[model samples]
Target: MRLADLTTIGVGGEPELIVDAYTREQLVSALNDAWDGDWFVLGGGSNLLASDEPFAGTVIRILTSGFARIDGAPEGFQRVSIEAGQNWDEFVAWTVAQGLQGVEAMSGIPGTAGAAPIQNVGAYGQEIVQTLVSVDLIDEGSSEIVTVPASELGLGPRTSELKRHYGEEPARVAVIAGITLDLRVVGTDPAPVADERIRAALSLASDDAVTLAQIRERVLAIRASKGMVLDPTDADTRSAGSFFNNPIIAEADARLLPESCPRWPVEEVAETVQVFDLATWDGQVPRVEAPASRVKVSAAWLIENSGLPKGFSLPGSRAALSTKHTLAITNRGGASSDEIAELARYVRMRVSGEYGITLNPEPVFVGVEL
Candidate 1:
């Protein structure tokens, strides 16, 4: 089957072989069998841009699904283990229906649950890192499955230790088999939303009463309005959720942008000191200082201000910016991979020339470059 047939963007060439793994054992066996060869693990196929040229490797499509309540949940929380291949939206729906609170704001995101931690998936102020407890996976060159805590994953903004960035290898090479989350059982209770971003989007005051169900409903509505939620009838949804990450640069660089540009300060995390062996300490006291804070500027703002408005496209190309969101570069039906790449490159150049800040893509590139 063509990669396009499986992906949300609908524009990838066929791989030499496609293997679907519907269970954990099948997934592990497939990985072991393809360990010495070129292979790519495909989850929901939502965040990818594969080349039109045929892939000369195996594509392992993860189809496993299931989740169950497990022991070891913290006070007032429940621990749930989900298979890597479970549909993320379906899981979110289940959580909301059960009155879980942590993931209510991330309701309409596409892709599988397994891919969530890889990019530290966040939306409407909720991130996977907030609830993720641990993951089960097989490390590279190892045949046995092992559990690793969330701390070891180096989860960050749209990045993780297992994520392979453009032209660089991941710090760790492993395939996730399942994940565990600790979620609060708030069940259908109306509570004040703590996330300012969510409140702003929903137009709710700080003290406004809202239920988890309400939040999910609003979040889904917002995403669908922006063509983020996948629907075959909506051509605008035929693209990776977001083409570029919101650029996080040094505070000084952010100051150079137009005053109207939206930006937020990245929180500074305090460094954890593991040990302080006084016996080996030097006589002199060491000086302590904090680094400068970073700022995250809006990519959509940059694109629109750089003379590329919503629905912009090349003269004769089928690829165009989503009419509903500037951040998405959509496939306007039958667009080639090159067309998508071309539009992305042009968007990057325009934004760079206008703001002197380079925009980085968020999707995994397979034989496709910008």
Candidate 2:
């Protein structure tokens, strides 16, 4: 089967064989076998780019799905467990319908729940790390199933231990089977919005009261306006949502950009791991301070200011920047995989030449090079 038929962008060649795992047992068995040879897991196909040539590895598509809810937890938080194959937006909608508040700001994200922690997916200042409890997975190294907590995933901006960045190995290897989340209950009552980013995204005034459902609706609307929500008829939506990640750089480098450019402070978190002998060692704790110096710059702002505008296209190619957002590269019907790569490289080159910064692609590349 051709990956084009399964992917959202609809541009790719055939795979040697495509197998779908509909149950946890089948998924686990497939994962165990995949470790013996070349293989990769496929989720919602929303954030992937395959080559025009036949894939030379095993492609396992995870289709297992189940949702379990446990109420009346500590401080009245709702605990829910869901399988990897469940659609993320559908799960978000379910939370809104149930009057849960934590995930309401991330309403229109594509892909599956299992892929969320891999990228630490977030929007409007809300990320999966905020509520993710754990993920059940089969480790590739030992071929054993294990439940990994959120703290061990190394969750960061669009990255985790399971994520494969360009020209770098992933910190960990495993197939996520299911995920658990914790959300607070508000009983369908309107309350003051807590996050500033959400308020700005929705253009709501401070002190404005809204419900969880309202937040979901407004977030979906914002995504739709940016051509982020999937739609068959909208060519702008025929692409991996964001092609490049917002670059996190040193605080000094961030100041070099134009004052008008959008920038956010990314604090450098220092986690100390110390081992001490509790039985004999004297109880004297030493504290040292380290400087926090990091900032995340907006890739879209850099792209536009670097001479590539929204809707810009390469010569004689069907690949172009989305008319609604500069961060996305869309397949304008019948585009070749090579054409897409050419456009991506051009964007990276221009941005680097103009700002002395390198932009990294966010999608997973299979049988393709850029």
Considering every candidate listed, which one attains the maximal lDDT?
A: 1
> What alpha-carbon RMSD in Å does predicted model 2 have with respect to the real structure?
3.9
Q: At residue 10, give the lDDT of candidate 1.
A: 88
Residue pairs with clashing backbones, model 1: 99-187
What lDDT does model 2 reach?
0.88
Global lDDT of model 1: 0.91
Model 2 spans > 4 angstroms off: 141-143, 268-292
CA deviation > 4 Å runs, candidate 1: 269-289
List pairs with backbone clashes in candidate 2.
none
List model 1 lDDT by residue over 1-370, tens digit each.
8889888888999899899999888888888888888889999999999998889898999999999989999888999999999999999999988887788888999999999999899997789999999999888767788999999999988899999887678899999999999999887889888889889878999999899989999999999999999999999999988999999998888888889999988777587454557899776656666677798899999999999999999999999999998999999999999999999999999999998889999999999988
What are the C-alpha RMSDs, in order, of all predicted structures? Answer: 3.0, 3.9
TM-score of each: 0.94, 0.93
lDDT against the true structure, each candidate:
0.91, 0.88
Q: In model 1, which range of ten residues has the least summed lDDT?
A: 268-277
| Candidate 1 TM-score over all chains jointly | 0.94
